[model samples]
Target: MDVDARLRELGLELPEPMTPAGNYLPAKAAGDLLYLSGMGPIRPDGTLVAGKVGDGGLDLDTAREAARLTGLQMLAAMRAELGDLDRVRSVVKLFGMVNCRPGFTRTPAVIDGCSDLLVAVLGDRGRGARSAVGMAELPFDIAVEIEAVVQVAP
Candidate 1:
């Protein structure tokens, strides 16, 4: 499928890829696999979506939206690294972390926002093994953070 066209059809515009905050590269290629470093919900205007989620914190829906925004950031990074989204063959796995209160147990539901978006854009190729867990804190108190492993065409 034409991934760029797919994005256009969805009325989604990818934000500019983020620069690495530390010494690590934003994404690294190992053979046909692309390992993406952890990414947060950075909006198109370059503002971060930061908060704790669940249990009197940011609501579930808002946290989910943050996860979706983080997904967009990942896509932006992928395009920067691969030059085209079409080069992605499949999503392999995702490690999603939600910043939440101690009792929060809906992390998977919140992370579904990103998962759902990927499936919408890439069809079956977007389905992947995933783990979603809650964290007491994350860098800059971002609502959600995620890292991905993707298979890419050489």
Candidate 2:
């Protein structure tokens, strides 16, 4: 399938790939696996959905949207690395972290926002192993941060 075409069909446009805020690269390739650094749900204007889940006015639904935004950022990074989304073979794994208030435990459901978006865009190729955890705080207090491992055409 033409992944880029699929994105268009879904009425989605790729955001600009984000530059690393630190010294690490956005993505690194090792054989078939492309490892993506932790990506935040940054909007086109470069604003983040900053807050803690279940606190500071952030809730599960909002945090879920943040996760979806992170998925978009992930794809943006992937395209920047491979030059095309069609180069992707499958999503392998995802490690999602949500910034939350104490006692928040619905992390998995929040990260599913990203998972669902991936499947909506990539079909079966989007299915993958995943883990979601809560964090006391994340860099910049972004609502969610996600790192991914993907398989790409070689």
* Superposed model 2: Cα runs more than 4 Å off: none
Shift in Å, residue 120, candidate 1: 0.8
Q: Judged by TM-score, which candidate is best?
A: 1
User: Model 1 scores what on Cα lDDT?
Assistant: 0.94
**Predictions in order: lDDT:** 0.94, 0.93
What tens-digit string does per-residue lDDT give for candidate 2 at 38-102? Answer: 99999778899999887555988998999999999999999999998888999999999999999
Model 1 reaches what TM-score against the true structure? Answer: 0.98
TM-score of each: 0.98, 0.97
Scored by lDDT, the top model is 1
Candidate 1 residue pairs in clash (backbone atoms < 3 Å): none
Go through the candidates in order and give the C-alpha RMSD of each one to the true structure. 0.7, 1.0
**lDDT tens readout by residue for model 1, 69-134:** 999999999999999899999999999999999989999999999999999898899999999999
Count the clashes in each prediction: 0, 0
